[model samples]
Target: MAEPVRVRRLTDQEGQRLRQIVRRGSIHAVRYRRAMMLLASGGGNGVPVIAQLVAAGEDTVRDVIHRFNEIGLACLDPRWAGGRPRLL
Candidate 1:
């Protein structure tokens, strides 16, 4: 069977930064959800529960986790290039 997904242990700075994001400011809701997911996973929540908690699908949750694992905290701000070139 496949192993469950989990975030690596966060440094004190990373944990603090995540807490700040979760607590304040007017960041996009997507960032908020992503922060929550990482924080919860770091605290031992699994992908399925994190998905339900954030109202997202399990696959989406897995993707977020994988992104964070691959690129650290930047996963919170996915840079989607602006919508495909408009078909003139």
Candidate 2:
């Protein structure tokens, strides 16, 4: 079987930051949701549980976990490119 998707061990600072975001809330909903996902995963929750907890899709939870594992806390706020591409 494939390994379960999970967040890696969080550093002290990363844990604190995630907690702060969850406790205090963030201006960006994405940040808040991502933080919650990470915290839940860190707390040993599974992807489905985290998804239900945050009212998000399991894929989203998995993506956040994967992103967090790959890029640490930076996954909290994704850089989405907006607007149509310019054809010069």
Candidate 3:
């Protein structure tokens, strides 16, 4: 069997910070933070485990992890790039 992915553990302060984010952040942000926390803490280390825990797809979990690793916390926010600009 393939070795399971190793997850980094969050510090107590980091856990508290994540809880605060989940409590006060926007819907998208909260969801992402919660998932990240779960994954980071080994609550669910693999994509399948995380997906089942969060009721999200494996791809979604992978994407969130990748985004957070690459871009820090800002990836939690849902950015809707504005539609095409109107010509003056």
Candidate 4:
């Protein structure tokens, strides 16, 4: 069987930041949801459960976990590409 997707051990600072984001919440929905995914995974929740809890797809949860592992807290706020610049 494939290994379960999970977040690596969170640093004190990362844990605190995640907790703060989950606790106090963020105006940015994506940031808040991603924080929840990481925090839940750190607490031993599986991808499916985290997906249900966060109302995201299983793939999305896995993606978030993988990204967090790769880039630390930077994964919480994704940098989406904006559309083409306006032609004035």
Across 1-88, the per-residue lDDT of candidate 3 in tens digits comes to 9655434565686566666665665367556555454445356567777677667777666676666666655556667689999899
Give Cα distance to truth, residue 67, candidate 3, Å.
1.0
Question: Compared with the true structure, what per-residue lDDT tens digits does model 2 show for residues 44-81?
Answer: 99999999999999998999899999989888877989
Regions of model 3 farther than 4 Å from truth? 1-14, 23-44, 84-88
Model 4, which residues run further than 4 Å from truth? 85-88
* Per-model lDDT: 0.89, 0.92, 0.61, 0.93
- How do the predictions measure up, each by TM-score? 0.88, 0.91, 0.58, 0.92
Q: Tell me model 4's lDDT, rounded to 2 decimals.
A: 0.93
Give me the candidate number with maximum TM-score: 4
Ranking by lDDT: 4, 2, 1, 3
Off by over 4 Å in 1: 84-88
Ten-residue stretch with the least lDDT total in model 1: 25-34
lDDT of 4 by residue, 17-75 (tens): 99898888788999999999999999999999999999999999999899999989989
Instruction: Give the TM-score (vs. native) of candidate 4.
Output: 0.92
Q: Which residues of candidate 2, in runs, are more than 4 Å off?
A: 85-88
Clashing pairs in 4: none
